[model samples]
Target: MHVFLTTERLGLRSFTDADTDDLFALDNDPDVMRFINGGRPTSREAIREQTLPRLLRDCPCLRTRSYWAAEEKATGTFLGWFEFRPLDDHSPAVVELGYRLNKAAWGKGFATEGSRALISKGFTDLAVERVTANTMTVNAGSRRVMEKAGLSFLRKFTGDWPEAIAGSEHGEVEYELTRADWQQRR
Candidate 1:
């Protein structure tokens, strides 16, 4: 497996065709899909046709895959994935950070650890000026992880969701860490 990044206990690597089954299981989990799709089941066809292609796509600015398959570094267990893609295909000035780990990995420090590593890499190596993340306002767990990773609350806004989920009424929140802010923190 081509590893892209690694934390103390987690490895982030490029997604491959072999990951179809793992992606299916992660998306099919009710708890995992709750905030994303209101616990709806994702068809395997969709994973192969849509999701996998997106995950495997290369970012023009970075000239590399932006979404990574995360796994346990030691045992190589498939955890989930992380995205640190540039918002604009041609510019590395701003990127969006995201993570989706399996239920088994929930509440573990893996999220914070991986997030911090990605942010540090973006600011120090990728020419990234800012890193941003967003989630539903009710997603306290995700928000906490963002905070722990050193991002500060930027704003709250309503997104155009085709199908509003359970906590859509409360809107969404954004958190960000600029290169300057990250440098100061260090």
Candidate 2:
């Protein structure tokens, strides 16, 4: 059976090709994509050709990754998706956590709540050593979510970003928390 993680009001379940509309809606909001793509919409072709396949079967970048949809438990509304995966090219213990929620779900603590759960699972269930998240330097909201979820600021650096967003020039900030750090905080 397929399993999912549940929060007080949300269910995080694996995403499939059927979620195309929901995914499209989530990424279509210009406000949501401001820091990521400068308010541009993502093409459905990209989602189908690259995003879905990577989140589902192909793990060319990282192995054993799972992409889950955040469904409102009460209404079964598709809020967005959260990703739990390893970040390393060769090592799988260095897990990473990320989320992209609809505008309706923003400012509701859903991001922080979901991220905390992913971090816990990465550390306890998956026995992962590190869990991290990143965002554009200007994305204060995202940085706050990672901090609220107990990740510490790692660093800021520039890389060959595929699509240059409005704030990409400010660099990307990495926030991370190790299993040991989580344990200590607990």
Best by TM-score: 1
lDDT of 1 at 35: 88
Candidate 2 structure quality by residue, lDDT tens digits, 1-186: 234689888788777779888877777899988987888888999888877787675343443446788888899898888887776656657877888888899999999889988888777877678988889888999999999999999999886789787889999999899989999999
Candidate 2 wrong stretches, greater than 4 Å:
58-64
Instruction: Enumerate residue pairs that collide in model 2.
Output: none
Pairs with steric clashes in candidate 1: none
lDDT of every model, 2 decimals: 0.94, 0.82
Winning candidate number (lDDT):
1
TM-score of each: 0.98, 0.91
Q: What is the per-residue lDDT of model 1 for residues 1-186, given as tens digits with 9 covering 90 to 100?
A: 678888899999999999999999999999998889999999999999999999999998887889999999989999999999999999999999999999899998989999999999888888999999999999999999999999999999999999989999999999999999999988
**Residue 32 lDDT (model 1):** 94
Alpha-carbon error at 49 in model 1, in Å?
0.5
